[model samples]
Target chain A: MKTDWKFILQIFLSFLKIGPATFGGGYAMIPMIEREVVDKKKWIRNKDVTEIFAIAESVPGAIAINSATFIGYRLAGVRGAVAAMVGVLLPTFIIVVILSMLFLIVKDNPHIESAFIAIRATIVALIVYAAYKIGMTAVYDKTTLGIATVTTAILFFLHVHPVVVIISGIFTGMVAVQIKSWFGMSIKLEKDELNVVKKEKQVKEA
Target chain B: MDVLVELFLTFLMIGFVSFGGGYAMIPVIEIEVSNHGWMTTQEFTDVIAIAGMSPGPIATNSAIFVGYKTAELPGAIVSALAMVIPSLLIILIIATFFFRFNENKFVKSAFYGLRPIITGLIVYAAIKFAITNNVIGELSWHTASLMIIFGLSLFSLIKLRLHPLFVIALSGFVGMVLY
Candidate 1:
């Protein structure tokens, strides 16, 4: 894609604004990013945004950063990617430095302590809200919902490690699919097999 | 030899190993911060709160905040970059290769298997935060029953398409008034 510095600059500034102002994390920034990228700038379509989200989640990076890199690359190129990444990160870098300096100067203040207590409590609620939003989109099917519910129960009640729970969920999902196949009710494999047969028939006819 | 380089390397290791992001990085961060005499446990917890509430990913923000505390602007830059580099490299590799094998059943199965695991991780994070932060610890009947309210708020959020910020603000108001 050809570089569009004007569009790239606008996207960069938008992400910079979002990076500092947003609380919680990547999930918290979604609605605002949607407003800017999808509604205002029209840089990408809503469906593309959703697909990018899925791709971002499946990959290793911060979802927001990954999305920015992809969108920036698509709009411009490598330079755009660098611009967007720096934009998203710079505000956070500056703010954290300032906050740390201030904290050093007033670490023992009573008012600061109480304010943090309040903020911490509020943050718990915010994290819950973020999880709830992500869950709504990610858990679409009944099977997925069941997995989510069971996993949540295990983690909440049993105090399983988060890594362990994630690993187990992966195992459980695979086993569930295998069991469904054994019961002659697996739609996924059947669809794949049907596609193979159709492709073979077309080849023979040609 | 230099404290800045040491801090940078430490955060780089943290970024490489800390899977699932945010809350998942907490324990590793606690170990490094306390081990290096960089900050106290209380300070670490406070930084986590600020990072969570301020913006961006918790791990990256924490690296920046803690690094700055330990050294200066250079420390902050190196730490933040260190925290981000591993994940960025991995994502780029995956993005390049994923589509080529998108339709492969084994790959599909692996990812399908991973869905529940991710859910479990999130659930585990929520519970740990609740306990560590005293959100649901030794509660009275009134406070204990607040789970029901949380549940309803979440339900309304999904079904009614309400913005999460509003829900968070409302919960904060309720906490301020009631708690």
Candidate 2:
């Protein structure tokens, strides 16, 4: 695909707006990204949008950047990737640079301190809201709830590292699936087993 | 050996270690910034606010903020790139290979399990941020009062589809007036 500079410019501006204005993190950017990219610009289809999101989450990078890179690469290949990355990052770079300068000048200023006090309180509320939104989707069943509750308890009480909990959760989930299969409750597992056995029989006959 | 290399490597390590995104990166960033005498605890809090107000992931914002503080425009570019590189490499690799195993049962189960764990980590992050910012704190009359406000605001924000920015602004107003 030929890289379109005009399209790249539009994307850059959109991301600049999103970067400066978005309150939370990656998840919070979704609605805005959808509004700008899918609904307004028609840069990608709905399924493509969903796939980008899934890819962003499963991968190890910042979700926003990954999504941008995917969408950019899809639209215009390497140049698009570069454009999107630069677009999303530019606003933050500018804002942070300015703030860093101002902070040095006012390191001991009383009003700046008060302003931060107020902002921090507000940020706390925003983070709580983000948690609630994610929880609604994630904690749907008893087993999932149990994992969340236990993970939270360990984090709060034991000061356990979150990565440890994440690893354990994956293990527990695998065990849960195994148990479900053992009890003949997993149709997917049964089907997989049946396919494997059929393949084994075919090989033996040949 | 140079200050720029030190700054770049610091951000690279921060990006590499931080999982579950922005909130998860806080402690690591704090350690790095403090260790290098780049920023103080209170100053770090301010940087977080700036990052929160801005966009493109908190870690990147912090890197930009910290880098610019240490050096200048060059510092900002280096730090931001360093923070992003690790994640970008991982994402690109995963994107290449993820589709081949899209329907694998174990992979599906693993992701399914990861959902709840990620949720828990996110929730814990919120609570920890609240506590660290002194939004909620050790039990006291003031703490209890703020907790009530917090709960009500949280409920309203969730149930009513209120714009979070507005809610955050309102809470800021309340803090300004009361605290």
| Cα error of candidate 1 at position A101, Å | 3.0
Expressed as tens digits, the lDDT of each residue in B30-95 for candidate 2 is: 657877888875567667766765655877887788888778888888999998777666655555
Give the TM-score between model 1's chain B and the true chain B.
0.60
lDDT of 1 at A138: 46
Candidate 1 whole-model C-alpha lDDT, 0 to 1: 0.63
Q: Residue-wise lDDT of candidate 1 within A1-206, one digit each (tens)?
A: 55667877876887787777776666566566667778888988876766665555555546677667666655666556666777878887777777678877875666565454444444445456555544544465667777777777776677555545555654665677788788997444222222222333346448
lDDT of 2 by residue, A25-48 (tens): 666666677677887889898667
Evaluate all candidate structures by whole-model CA lDDT and list the values in order. 0.63, 0.68
Q: Model 2 misses residue A6 by how many Å?
A: 9.2
lDDT of 2: 0.68
The TM-score that candidate 2 achieves is 0.74
Clashes of each: 2, 1
DockQ of each: 0.38, 0.47
